[model samples]
Each structure stands twice: as structure tokens, then as C-alpha cells.
Target: MDPFVVVVLSLSFLLLLSLWRQSSGRRNLPPGPTPLPIIGNFHLIDMKNTRQSFSNFSKTYGPVYTLYFGSQPTVVLYGYEALKEALIDHGEEFSGRGSFPMLEKVFKGKGIAFSNGNVWKAKRLFTVNTLRNLGMGRRTIEEKVQEEAQWLVKELKKTNGSPYDPHFIMGCAPCNVICSIIFQNRFDYEDKDFLSLIGKVNECSKILTTPECQENGNQQTIYSLDHLASLVTGLFFAGTESTGTTMRCALLLLLKHPHITAKVQEEIDHVIGRHRRPSMQDRIHMPYTNAMVHEVQRYADIAPNSMVHEMTCDTKFRNYFLPKGTTVIASLTSVLQDSKEFPNPEMFDPAHFLDGNGNFKKSDYFMPFSTGKRVCVGQSLASMELFLFLTTILQNFKLKPLVDPKDIDITPIGSIFSTIPPTFQMCFIPI
Candidate 1:
């Protein structure tokens, strides 16, 4: 029981532990900041600004590096080169969704967004085919979007040039669109059940919004109550929340840059004419408006890091060995904001998606929805809704910020889960 003996034994044990970790870390895993015993490199993270902190780490450790959250080692993919390589080129090995405690608590890992293995494959195929059958790319879906856009414009007009926050007003249209697809019918915005469902989208818990399902065939038999609940909630969160937030960002950005807004309205008017609502076909002819929507998505850079991807098996990527079940984050923010791909990447410029000839330009790095085999299932539907909703609003209203355009802060508020637009009021005047 000698104190000196105890101290010497403790010191020796610590030395051995450090050596073991060093040997393991250097064997094949990507290099990163040395982690502490339990906390790992969590102390190195700037919780308030996660993307910037990750970018700073990339500067020190190159594009691919490891950061430990507690005992779990998470490999982060930075910039377009690294992101594209892992998510697209080597997709199969990196397609599995990692364990997310909060999402697991809600989804129970049953739906397409968070599920892996056979469950995910079955649900994804069913959902995609169902959406296609429901006319996702056809005029049937476009007509629904146009109808919601009309309702949105009607609601916005009620403000009568008053400065008001458009968050709920913006959200209702997208929420109903997803509702129609999932429940086979849309609810009135004023309906209590509809409002209650919208409020549950952000909660890290199960929602009680049930869809009316009819016994059809093998697919219906496979889809249990849990399956349907998870699917509906997953689609609601993905379909409603992200799309609504992006539209809010688009409007705020337009208000911040009135000249840009003017140009978009002009393009909409010239291409589609004021007498009718915009359509998917019109997206081709209205390059400038299309570019503006692209720019909004790029600038918002929502979902900076993708939902974690687990390595299906041990894989070698970019000359680094990633072990089986290793957690990976494809940083969408890094790709969208890469200066090489986008000149003045921080600036809100539609020219990023426009060619010198004024045509809508597509970039391999425009990955707001993430990419690869696991790209968002609602991609086509969300795109149609964003285009129609935004153009319709612009066609009918002039969004004037209460303050000077330069004074408006377009910097997003939330940093961890999403890069949300700051709260501000704008006067939606009828044109």
C-alpha cells in the first residue's frame, strides 16, 4: 500500500496504453488528432460551427482524416474530390447508414433514409416505384405542385405588403404535397390535424400521423404498421422540412439581392408569361430562374454533413484503409463551397450555376441531396416542388426587405443539423 509504488504502477500503465493506441492508429487508419482515453478528439470540435471546424481539421490532415466521437472513430470526407470518390466511385462499400441514436429512437431504423440491408433495399425500391407510378416526373405531380404554389401565393397575398415571417406559410405547401403522396390526400392548412403533424417533424420522437392504406398485394402485406409509420415520417421530414427551409432561404436571398430577384421575375415572366403557373418544361426555357434555385441550394448548403454512412466492409479509399462498420460523413458543404468548383464560393451568385451564354449549368459538386446509390428518394419530387413554388411566388409578388438589401443577414442560423436562414420579415407586395 505504498503511495510511491502506486504512482509508479499508474504511470507505467498509462505509457503502455499510449503506445498501443499510437501503434493501432498508424497501422492503416487515416491520420488525425490524437484522441484522449474516452473523449477522443471531441474537444477539438467547435460545436457552434461544425463545418468550419471540420474544414480546419482537413487543412491539417488532408482531405480524408479521422475524428473520434467518444470511442467511435468517424472518417470525414472533405471537398468535392474526396466526397465524389467515396460516395460515387466507391459507393457500394460506403452505402450503409450508420447508427444514429436520435433517428433510431424515432425511425427505429426502418425507413429508407436511415435503414440498411434488406429492409432499406425493399423500402427504397417500393418507394421509388410507387412515386414513379404516382407520376413523380410527369405532369400529374407537376400539377399538384402548381396547385400548392397557387395556394401559397394566395396566403402570401393576405399579408397585404406587411412585413411578416414566411416560415409557416412557406412550410405548409411542401408539407401538403408530401401528405398527398403519403396519405393519398392533402389536408387543409387550417386543419388542426395537419398543423399538429407539421409540428412533429422536428421532434426526435415517433409521430402519430397514420396514412390510410388499402390491402393491395405482396407489397402491402410486407409493409406493417411500423414500416408505414417510419416511411411516412421519413418522407415527411425529408420532403417537408428540408424543402420548406430551402424555399425560405431562396426568398431571403432574393430579398437580400433585389437586382437578382428582379432578374428572376423578369425571366419567369418572359418564359412562362404571367397568365399561367410555371411547369417543369418551363425550367428548361427559363435558365436564369433555374440558376437562381440552384444558387439558393448551393448557398444554403443545408445538411452540411450527410447522415452517417457505415462501411459495408473494410475498404481502401484514396489510399487510406477504412475498416468495416466505420462511420463516414460526406461533407456536402465542402463540395458546394469548394473555391475550385465555385469561384467566390461564399458569395450568393446565381452565376455559379449559369454559363456565359446564360444557360443553366450543372456541376458534379451540386450535391445538396448527397449522392450515390443512397441519394434522396424524393429528389425528383422535391426539385419539381421547389421550382414551381419559387417561380409562382416570384411571378405574383415583389419581396421587399424591411431594411436595406446590404443590411440583411443571409447567414444561416442553425449550424449543427442544418444551415437554416436567419429570421426576418419581408413585404410580399402583389405585382
Candidate 2:
């Protein structure tokens, strides 16, 4: 045989073996787009907007499908039914944390946000107990958030209707709240140390560490000082970024649609009035404002992919098998943006949460904070922060967009993991 033919045969044999192995591994998995030897379905994915790519896959492959991330086969649970089935119905078996190499490098799987199995359970319990002890949905943390809202309003008053980017100001409120939870104190807006602290949080943040939590921790295995540090950092990053970005997106949407902002303000006036601080008590009476807040989260669609999950065992789900250790991604974008649940989901309408009689209507499709066993730990706290902070801002002043409402763009800056509002300036015209 010719030398070229021999070399070509060797390469062909290797390629065939690689493809055969990939196929054998994916045998019992849900059907999906076919994979090439190494790259797999990566070419089908849009690096900038992976959620849409995965969603697109569901068109042919149905609600559940598999995609290859390099040589690794990962399952994607898209749409409401599939997500509910996996994250809610089969919650435990699907609740194990999945891998993300870059984030893993930073988090090291020691904290609650990244850890799995016994470590996850232990840390999750400790964090939950601490929050409950600190009064998460009750008056304690609420008072701290309300106090911070007043401070946030004070800073806006300083702006005095001048056009400015709200990026940092929007961030400070949530950052301080999480800080108060962790450190038992809040910082002045312009404090030099505060700025430095926020810069670090911007780099990476989360944790509500107390002496009690520290002393209570085992400090022998998963409860080491390192685990505590990662938890704090995870809290700072997770708590601050998601809540702050959502608030900022709320403001942007208000600027883009003044009518919605007006309706929210009108509700604020009717329920809480200008003289009093907005409370969780107001959320019940202020249906429109509450709906608007839910709409903001749904429309903003922040945290698109959510934290990935790894299967705890070889699980049978909806006629398909997810082998033990298989990685799964429940596409949050699909759930939040489902047209069947929210008519014209692409439209930014608070009416999605409103009944025909005008009462606030709740839908099961609202999973902005995600669902099931691994639901965001700060869901209640974050909800309180968003509602209080938003209502307070609208109550104190009106959003004055620098441009015409029609011209103001409300589109989010899309990422593989999150949907963030673009940077823009607006005025906080005192009402």
C-alpha cells in the first residue's frame, strides 16, 4: 500500500473509534442533534445566546434533548412542563450541582452555591437557619432593607433630576442589604471603604457570615474556613448581582414604558401614599405594583440558564433515561418566556400577572428565581428587596428618561448565563 494510504487509514480508524464511543455513551439518553466526534453540538450553539440555541433544539427534539459540550453529553430540560417535571417532580435526583470549569475554579465546590451531596446539605441548612434566625421574610431584614431604601432615595434626591447612569447607584442598594445580612452593618454611599468593598463584590461576592455561623461550623471537613469564605463570596456575587441587575432592569423598563411606571406609581399613591415608607404590607393591597414587579423579573429574564444540575442517580424521566452523573440544564428562559402560560410573552405586560377582574393573578410559569430543591435561597429576601426598593423609588420620584419613551431601548444585553439591561442614563425627577 502507498504510505499516504497507510497514514490516511490510521487517521480514519481513530475517527471511527471516537464516533463509536460517543454514540455508545449517548445510547440511553434522550434524543437530540447528532454530535460530531469532538466538538459535538457546539457548532449549533450560538456562544452569545446559548439559551435560544437550546430552545431551538427543542423544536425538533421535543422538550427534553441532549447536547454535547465537548465530549461530554449534557441534557437540557426546556419549557414549563419539562422543567417542572425535572426540577419540581423529580427534584432530588436532579438537584445535584453540575460543573462549570471557570466558576468551579473560583468557587472550588466548597460553598453552598457549588458544593453537592453532604456538604451542600450541611451548608444549605446552616445558611437557611441563619437567614431564618436573622428574620428573612419577617421584620428584622425587612427593616434593614427599608432603611436602605430610604438611603437609596436620599442618594437619588442628590441627583436632583440630572441625567446620570444608574449602574452604581442601583448596585449599592442590594450590595448594602447583603452586607447588612453578612456583617450586621450598612455603609454610606460615598464611603471610600464602601466603594472599595463594592469593587471587590463587583469582582465576586455573597455571604452572611456571623460569629455564630463561624462557631457553629464543624471546621473539620466541608465546614472549614475555606468553605465559609466561599459561601460569603458566593453570597456576595450571587445576592448582589442578581438583585441589583433586576432592579436596574426594572428602572430601564419603566423608562422605556412610562405608562407602566405611571400605573405602578398610581398604585403606590393609592396604597402607601407619599408620607409613609412602602412595606411588605403594601404588596398585598398594591396589586398593580406587585404584578409590575413580577413582570419586570419575567421580562428582564435575568439568570437565563440558572445553575446547572447533575443527576444523583440513573434516573428514568418522561420515557428517557438520565444516567448517574449526567449533567442537566433546565433552561429558565424557556420557562419565563413561555407563550402558552403568558400570552404574548415577548410583550412587557404586567397584565400577565393580572386577572380579568384586576386582582393579581399568579401563574405557575413564574420561575424567575427558579424552582424546586435548588431554588435560589434568597428568593424571598430578593423579592422583598425588589418590591420595597422599586415601590419606594417610584413613590419618591418619577423616572425621567433622557430620550423619548419610544426611542428608549429596553432590550437586554444577552449572555450565556444572564440577561442584563444595557447601560443608559435617565433623570430621577422628584414627584
Candidate 3:
């Protein structure tokens, strides 16, 4: 009878007891695949195709269900109805941002994208107000976008219709736009300092698994330098990568469907004309073009899993109990790809967002930037940038794929956090 054997038996007994309690506790919670003791349902999910995995889980568990990420219970809301219920209808109850281990190290919970409670409320209000003051929805922002689009077009023209990789060029444009908005000035694409900053932003974006937390700063009312850095980093990272990736995906899809690309160019030409740059005002007049943009956001479905949210308190939702601190996800991919809303959701059809009269159509299910109280703060700005940049490029040049349109692969390279488009070079033939 060794002491080590006695201790081992005690530990084993406690582990079994904990597992029993965990199983019994979930009786009133949303049904999900039975999770093991330590790993939980982590094995149930395909790390690569997490979005598709969640979608598959929904087929068995219904729209609202539970899954364990490690030992934490995470409730996932799939499709438009469940998303609307939790995110919009019960917005306040579900407004808490979920914790992330990696982001906590970086953000320390100071940024608007990840902070919750009073910190989130104050920062979000300040950010929204600051952005509005800086002309987010105004002409100043439009001009900045136009200027960047001009820069992008010039760089693209340098390729001279020869094969040139566009990943960096595409990234630079949107990243500079965020720079201009946050710093009140844009940086040269090749400037060493600016390039370094862009590198940091890229790093933050790639660490998608990171969660965030907050602590008190020097001045109670003002954000400390660390907090400010985290805040700006989050903004620049989100503002640049998501929008840039979407634009890249849009171009890739357009190259694949030349007819659709032609239609977009035609609409841009007709509504804004070549003499004048495409403006937000022109968006209302160009239904086909507008629909194309919406379709691109929907089809690309960049941020498949929306930012994680945590419950502030134990909450009863749709007859299921979600405990306090449980992480929650409203799958944008599920909503975007809902076949019930978008017929043949797999196909990249702008007609999904167009009526028979060729007018732009809208759907409650289009939640690419997500919906509800915590929808992306830069949503409007991102929309403007995407529209302006995409149209301006189309207005100036016709994009030609290096390979045959049919041979072009539109599949995203990375699928876990973001739907990163494959590295590609396109011929930006001048019009």
C-alpha cells in the first residue's frame, strides 16, 4: 500500500465525481454532443473547418445548441431566427464579450472589440463618437477612401498587365485608410515605420484565438498608453484585414465570373461614370453594383464565427439554461449561408440580393459584419471603403485572371478564423 497509489485513487475518484456533476448540470442546458471530462467537445469540432463543423452540429442539435470548448460551455446560435433572438431581441443580456487567452495578453481587455461591462460601454461610445467626429460617415472619410483607391489603382497599373501578386497591394490600401482615420494622416506604402505598424496589425489579426481582459489605468477617466495601443491595434487590425480580405475575395470571385464583373463595371460606368469617382450617393442608384457588394460579403463570409460573447448572468433562453460566463457565438456563416433565405446559398449570385425589378434587396439573414448591440463599430466605414475601392478599381481597369476564369480557385486558404483568399496575381488592364 504505497502513498502514491492512495493519492492516485483519491484523484481518480474526484475526477469521476466532477464528470458526473458536469453531465448532470447540463440536463437543462441546450443539448449537444456529450463532452469528455477534460477535453470536452474539442474533438467533436474540426479545427480547420470550424464553421462547417458548427453547421453540421446544428443539423442534429437544432438552431440553438451547446458545445464545450475545453471545459467551458459555449452556446451557439445558428441561422437568422436564433441569432436575432439572442443578439438583437435579448441584446443586453448577451452583450458581454467572451474571454480569450491570447488576446487577454495583448488587449488586456481595453479595446472596444473585446471589452465588456462599463469598460466596453465607455470605450464603444468614445470610439463611435470619435470616429463620427473624424468623419466616418461624412465626406472627409469618403475623400480619404478615394485617395487610397487612387493610390491602389496607381500601384496596380505598375504591373502593366503582367502577373503580379496583389496580396500586399490590397492590404496596403485598407490599412492606410484605417491609418488615416485613427492618426489623421495616411502613410506611404513603403515607409519603414508604416510597414512595421502594418506588420503588428497583421500579427494581431492572425492570433484569432486570443481573448481579452481589462485593468485600471493611470488616470481613471483616460485610457493608459498600453490600453490605447491595444485599442488602436484592434481597430487597425480589424479595420484593415477584414475589409481587405473581403475586397480580395470580391475580386477573386469577379475574375471567376467575368459576366458579373462586367455588370459591376457597367453599373459603375452608368451610375457614377468614368469622369466622376464612384461615391456613396451613387450606391442608391446602382442596384446591381450594390447587390454585388452585399453578395460578396455574404458569399465570402469572412468572419464566419462572430466575436465570442459571454453571458453576464445565468440566463434562460428558449427553455434552455445558459450559465453565467458561458461563451456564446452567433455564427455569421450559418446566417449568411442559410439556404432558406438565400436560395442556392452556395452559389455566388448577386441575384440573391436583387429583386425581379433589378432593385437592391436586403435580408435579415445577411450578418457578415454581424448584427445586434455589438455589431462591428467600423461596419459603415468598411462598407464605404469596400464600395469605393472596388468600384474605383473597376472604373479604372478591367481585372483579368492570370489563368482561365474556370480554372481560378475561389476557395479560401485558411478557414479557422478568417476566410483568407489564395495568393493570386491579376492583370489590372487599364480601361
Candidate 4:
């Protein structure tokens, strides 16, 4: 072929490419703000700060909206109804976990949390069954939690009414409980390796949620083994930080509302007595305490964007075509805050989980661990830990803020990962 002919062919090819993109763009994806070329809607997205941005986007584009980060098209699901429909009604179709370049390079699909398809199924089943077999919902697990709670109480008592940050100490107790369950061991507070691991987990949480870390230019090419490591890091980080943060939030709420704390303590004292540690069996008799725990999970809503799933095949959602491989985020925060679901979404009221007769009432939208097939694998363990830890601490000691309640900040500071643990000193006055 002559040089002139080759040049003409190249120009024609470029023209066709542009036309093809334009045609494809006309497809009816769920409605959202128009995206700029190459970058898509990324410029408009605040990856660092997602909660408010996601809520605002949902308002303008409806509950289900489409967005583009680089070349990736993501679907954002907000509120209870949309989340339930996508995560539960069409769960299998939306079970594919989308991996960021860094995480894909790191976790290479080895763990239960990040792995998907048949491997994910196998791992998830094995984990859930193993937990159950190990007495997750039974007395054995409760004993472990109570033991950890005792250690936490001792640590708190050491503070001797002095103001100190409880975030790290409170987080570590539950973390150790999970560690004990999984690794079948516990770590001392001063263990260097354990402390290092905790720090790494916290750092990874911040790194994974940063918009800069997810940007096209920022992503590094990671192979299978590297990906596996990244996934493990992510799991450890998510598993520990989220539950720990929520526990801290629970303590904060108790401190801010002494009446609520007193009620829970009264129930514990009457049911379990201070002579022995409280166990799972006591949960049934302690309705008020159980309701308070459920309220903490609901109001905290720690893992705002629980986990991202992808469409495995082309599908129709409410007359809109969502193509295969589109990433979907289930905004758990919205579901927890839904007015129809929780009458007073903003107020931290235990009544949300109680009826007029003071009996425990179940709400369809109280999905702090999320709902559907890919729900939190450690849900049972987390519940046991929170209940035991909170009740145990409250039974023996009172939680009060080091500073005034007005000075305690509840606003979350970081994006993607919200760790809004109150920064106040509190004394554990022995009861």
C-alpha cells in the first residue's frame, strides 16, 4: 500500500471510532449527570467524601443512578427499597465484586470477603458454617466476648476517672475477640506485632477510600499474588476498624444519654447480676439492653458503602438497561436513615427498635451488616461482641465524657471510610 492510502485509512478509522462511541452513549443507562470524556463523571465525584455526595446525587438522579469513574460505569443504589431490590431480589446477578486496580493486584481472589463466583461461594459457606460450628450464636461465643469485655473493663478502670482516648482501647477489645475466633488466640495490649497490625489496618482503611488512590494515574499494575495481599489487608482493615468504630459510637451514645445507659445497666444488673459476667443467654431476658445494641448498629451505620457489587450480565432495572460489569454500590447509610423505615432517623433513640408495649420490634430496613447474599460474613460474631462488650462495661462501670457533651464531635472526618469516633476523655466510675 502507498503511504498516502495508509494515511487516509487511519483518518477513516479514527472517524468511525468517534461515531461508535457516540452511538453507544445513546443507550439508556440509569439517568445521571452527563460525564466528561475519558474522565467520565469522575471530576464531579468526591471519592474522598462520598456519603453526602452520593445522597445528593440520588436526590437529583433518583435512587438508582449511573456514574463513570475513568472508563468504568458504576451504579449507585440509595435508600432501602432500591438497595433491597438490587442486593436481595436480584442478588445473584449483582454478586460480582468489582476490583480496583490496586486491590485486584493485591488480593488476587484468595479471601472470602473479596473473592467471588464459585470460589466466593465456597469460602462464604465454609466461613459461615465454621462460625456456626464453633458456636457463633451459642454460649461458647458469648463466653469469649464476655472474657474480652472483662479485660476491657479492667483497662478502663485503670484510667481512674482521668480523661483518655478510648477509641484505640475500645477498638482493640472487639478486634481481639474476632482474632480469637479466627486465629484461635488473643493478643496482649502491649504486643508490638498486634499493635503494628492494628495500625496497618487503620492506615489501609484510609488509603483504600482516598479518591487519589483510585485515580487512573495513581493506580499501579499489581499481579495475582500482590492482589491477594491487598485483599487481605483490606479485609483486616475493614473487619477491625468498622466494628471497633461502631463500638466506640455506642459508648459515646451511652455517655451522652446517662438515662439510657442507666436503664441498660439496670436491666443487666437485674438479669445477669454483677457476681458473674453476662452471657448470650442473658440477652433474651435483657430486652432493653438488646434494643440498645440494635439501636447502636442502626444509628452508627459504620460501613456506609458496605461493599461494591457488579452486574454479571446485561439486565433491566425499572425499565433501564444496566450493562454487564457495571459496578453497583449499596448505600447502607441511606437505608438506616430512611424515614419510612426509622420514624426518627437522626435521633439516637432505642425506641426505634421497640414498640409501644416495650417489646422488641424488627424493622425491615435495619441493615447495618447489610442484606443479601454478600452480607457481612462476621455478622453473628459482631453482634455477640457488641452486646457482651457494651453490657459488660456498663454493668461494672459508668461511661462519661472527659470533656463536655457539647465538645464531643460526631461528624465523620474522612471519606469512603467514616471513623467518627468521639475525641473525648472519659472515666470509668465503678458502680
Per-model lDDT: 0.83, 0.85, 0.84, 0.76
What tens-digit string does per-residue lDDT give for candidate 3 at 1-431?
89999999999998899789879878988999998888888888877778779889999999998897767788889888898999999898898999777667777778887787777887888789988998888899999999999988888888888877777777899999988888889888889998897787677666763221142433464466766777788888888888888888998999999999999988887788887877889999999988999999999988887778888788899998888888898788988998888999999999999989999988888888888889999999889988999999999998888889999998775544566777788888999
Tens-digit lDDT track of model 1 for 1-431: 89999999998898779758855865687888887766777788876678889899999999999988876788988988887788889988998998776567777777788888767778889888888888777877888888888888888888989989998878889999987776678888899999898888745312211100011224553488888778878888889888988999999989888899989988987898888878888999988888999889989887788678999898987778888889988888899999988999989999999989988889998998999988998888888888999999989998888998999987666544566777878899999
Candidate 4 contains a number of clashing pairs equal to 11
Better by TM-score, candidate 3 or 2:
3
Give the C-alpha lDDT of model 4. 0.76
Candidate 4 C-alpha lDDT tens digits along 141-260: 777788888888888888887777787897788778767776788899879988998887666556654656421111132224454455446446656777788888888887777789
Give per-residue lDDT, candidate 2, residue 363. Answer: 88
| TM-scores for every predicted model | 0.92, 0.94, 0.94, 0.86
Name the candidate that leads on lDDT: 2
What TM-score number comes out for model 3? 0.94
lDDT of 1: 0.83
Candidate 4, poorest ten consecutive residues by summed lDDT = 214-223
Residues 226-257 of candidate 2: C-alpha lDDT, one tens digit per residue: 88899888887777888988998999988888
- Candidate 3 runs further than 4 Å off: 2-11, 209-222
> Which residue pairs in candidate 3 have backbone atoms (N, alpha carbon, C) closer than 3 angstroms, thus clashing?
100-211, 103-210, 103-211, 104-211, 108-213, 109-213
Cα deviation in Å at residue 384, candidate 1?
Answer: 0.8
Query: RMSD per prediction, one decimal?
Result: 4.9, 4.7, 2.4, 5.8
